[model samples]
Target: MRSALIAGTLLLAIIATIFFDEVRSLECYVCSRQEGNAEKCLTTTKTCESDENACQSEIRWGSTPYWSQGAEKQYYVTKKCAKKEDCEEYVNRFTSSCQRIWYEDWKCGECCQGDRCNYYIIMGAGNLKATWLLSLVTAVVIFRHIFAS
Candidate 1:
């Protein structure tokens, strides 16, 4: 009975470590962006004039939704441009479908700012740390069971 208990504990510890390790390594792509300046207004083939001077924008990372306790949180990353070419390049990086703002068009919200991107990375790292700690605890438990038994 003692041996069985020890073996069970060891197995549980190993499973916990694997679970936490997998969670720690989970790559949840949040968002990233490159910033620049604008210089001129470029017209698309659709007759839409994307002002080059209007600031370049890039969605370094796309938006993702997080849900908790009946609340939903959205996250994304965006880069702003200071020159016309910069803004144009930022806009051009996406497909024509992503350029639209209204219905049927995708638009990035305020949460998609550069500062938020930093926050996302920080939070992601915290999650990773938590997972790592869980794995470490599991490893310690397993080691204790193996040698102390």
Candidate 2:
């Protein structure tokens, strides 16, 4: 009986801790195209500033001559942590569409909430957290209520 009571109390404490946990700042992929290498951005991540709640990505596409046969197209990308408002304004600046430059280069950008949301140039927020902790707490609460009654 004593062991059962102690276990129940421990479970409740764990549940309460989870409920009162501090909120974490959003994390995002952060890098820029350097020396024509955009892939470097894929390996770095940053915990965004408290006010920087969004992930932003910009992609630039252009055509380059391929020696003889034809012109090959290529794109460079950049990613960073940003504020939602700034990202929204940028995405909306072009009427939600890519802008054409020099008739060959196209520039596009996007923003998203959640961690690593800017990992993809065009994708939105990442997957949400699982709810198994909530379910476990609920189950424990019900068990304790039944035991007390």
Candidate 3:
């Protein structure tokens, strides 16, 4: 009887974890060539197609030669649903990270899993690198501390 109780408890815990830990469908911010980091990009949300497993954000510059934000008209951002494999492929092929080149006209692509995981993506070179770097470092420290114990 005690053995049966232990088995049942273990099964219950496993099932509970499976059900509670991860989400089935991914959500992402949906914006297209929005000028600047518009407020709409931050607040807008959408459920991606079932096949899309990730969210992607890119910084685009149009017809600008200078290495600085030319104008609100020149700088734009597009954040949308993406497939994890595709986004990763581009990131691997073209650049090391979405950060760097915080100058101007830097084509940045980044993807993440989980619901609304791409919410932290910011435009512009300086702020984008700093924010993402800070977030990445903080997350690393937290995970290390949590797992090290």
Candidate 4:
């Protein structure tokens, strides 16, 4: 009975390791943009397609200076599974979808072999600009009211 118990435990351990490896191999996050007021966006897990082996995260920032609101900045972040070659290509270069937004203010692309590695991406500049603009507007309104009254 004792021998049987030892053999069963060994078998269970082996099976557990195999199952864990299988589950860890192909998981990734797929999302077009991050949302909410949180510091980082929450991403859902997904199994990568058969041809995909790398996790990739990409961010694009656009700037426009046409208005009185100062330079408006736009950001787009994406996370997904992709082929290794494609991931490498993206890392070296980027393509712009909008012709009008000539200044791609900032861009970042990362590729990783591990599962779910593309989960978190943060770009502080855009958020800081937005917050600063809000504060400036608020201060202007407050001053205007004080002077008028």
Ranking by lDDT: 2, 3, 4, 1
Q: By the TM-score metric, which is better: model 1 or model 2? A: 2
How well is each residue in 1-149 modelled by candidate 2, as lDDT tens digits? 77567667767776665554325687888877532324677778999888887888887676643434455657767788898899889877854447555456577778877667676676544434233356476667767765886
Model 4, residue 95: distance off in Å is 11
Best by lDDT: 2
Clashes of each: 16, 0, 1, 0
Candidate 3 CA-lDDT value: 0.64
Tens digits of per-residue lDDT, candidate 3, 1-149, equal 55555555655555565455334566788888777667877889998887887788776655444446444326577788888799778757657444344443456677776666666664221213243354456556555655555
Which pairs of residues have clashing backbones in candidate 4?
none
Off by over 4 Å in 3: 1-23, 61-74, 96-104, 122-149
Worst 10 residues of 2 by lDDT: 124-133
Candidate achieving higher lDDT, 2 or 4: 2
lDDT of 4 at 91: 72
- Compared to the true structure, candidate 2 yields what TM-score? 0.59
Q: Identify the runs in model 1 with alpha carbons over 4 angstroms from their true place.
A: 1-4, 9-13, 16-76, 79-129
Per-residue accuracy of model 4 over 1-149 as CA lDDT, tens digit each: 55555555655555565556545556667776553212343447678887887777776665533434456676666778898799879877753432334454666776766556565553221112233345456556555655555
User: TM-score rank, highest first?
Assistant: 2, 3, 4, 1
What is the TM-score of each predicted model, taking all chains together?
0.27, 0.59, 0.58, 0.51
Q: How accurate locally, in lDDT, is each candidate?
A: 0.37, 0.69, 0.64, 0.59
